[model samples]
Target: MEFMLDLAVSVVSLLVVGFYTWSLRGHFYSPKMATGAKLISAVVIATTLFFLYLAWYEHQVAWVQIVGLVIEICAAALFWWAVSASRKARLRFAFDPDHPDSIVTTGPYRYLRHPFYTSYLMFWSGWAIASSSTWAVVPVIAFVIIYVSAALGEEKKFSKSPLAPEYEAYRRKTGFLIPRFDQR
Candidate 1:
């Protein structure tokens, strides 16, 4: 039972990542970060990969792993939904200096301003937990910082876009990495 669950987790994660990565490459991505946030991103990616490899698959499926997997699945679903919704809205997935193709408010974007980063964090959390290594959380913390920085960077860029005013309003209502219910 645990083995099957493990396999399911691994396969689902790979498929979602592979599909998203491919889809994202089709758009014009910003070659730069809004404010040098790119520096930490490199460390984040390298550490994440190192920790993920350290958390080898086939570890005992403990409660923590199961919880992490559940979060990962849900985050992946949200990520997929947001991406599809954005594409449907013709919102190009780039971060160029120019204005964004559109300001997305549908799907996950309505709740979290950066669902992709949120999804990555959730996925990383799951993999780290499943590894059953207490030390895995260290890299995971770095992962969170990196994504949060990237999300903030996006907001900074958005602030300069044609949708600056609208984006500001949206930011008030949306959380950076998670859904915020403080606003109606």
Candidate 2:
């Protein structure tokens, strides 16, 4: 019974995220340039399923689970920050071969070149931790690897567009996921 419930929850969550991602796809990818996007979608679904399995069958919940949940919350906050920042820049996902007219540099982007990816990673990591299964960590690591690869692939595509130089400059200044503090 619990397994069934978990499966249903996982499916519903995936559907919601899938639809949301599909809608945003137009803003980020060009026509016929969806291969990378599709790959990312697959990774997300697979990783979600992996986490669900672990949550259902693996380890006991512990204090660390709470820590993981907290981390997940922080990740959600970061995701919101990215979305809001993107909106402020008036940039929609190009979803085309061409880059958007504006390259965002404010808000979370000021700290990380890819806040959206970072947020997604954080969310996934938190979810894994919250599952409190020893195996849950595997999916989290896999998701990170896949996401990074996909991000780099997308970056390669974007590099040829007008926004390339600007993005490169931003990348040089910001960490990909971690924020840098001036120790000096």
RMSD of each: 3.7, 4.5
Give the runs in model 1 whose Cα sits over 4 Å from its true position. Answer: 26-59, 88-101
**Mind giving the per-residue lDDT tens digits that candidate 2 earns over 1-184?**
4454444445544543554475465334344545655666676778777776666676535565566656666776776677777764544332334455677777887777678778778777777766767677776787688768756755776687788888777667777678644312
lDDT of 1 by residue, 150-184 (tens): 56666887788888999999988989887886776
TM-score of 2: 0.72
Pairs of residues clashing in candidate 1? none
Superposed Cα deviation of residue 180, candidate 2 (Å)? 2.8
- Look at candidate 2 and tell me the lDDT of residue 68: 62
Against the true structure, what is each candidate's TM-score? Answer: 0.76, 0.72
Error of 2 at 131 (Å): 2.0
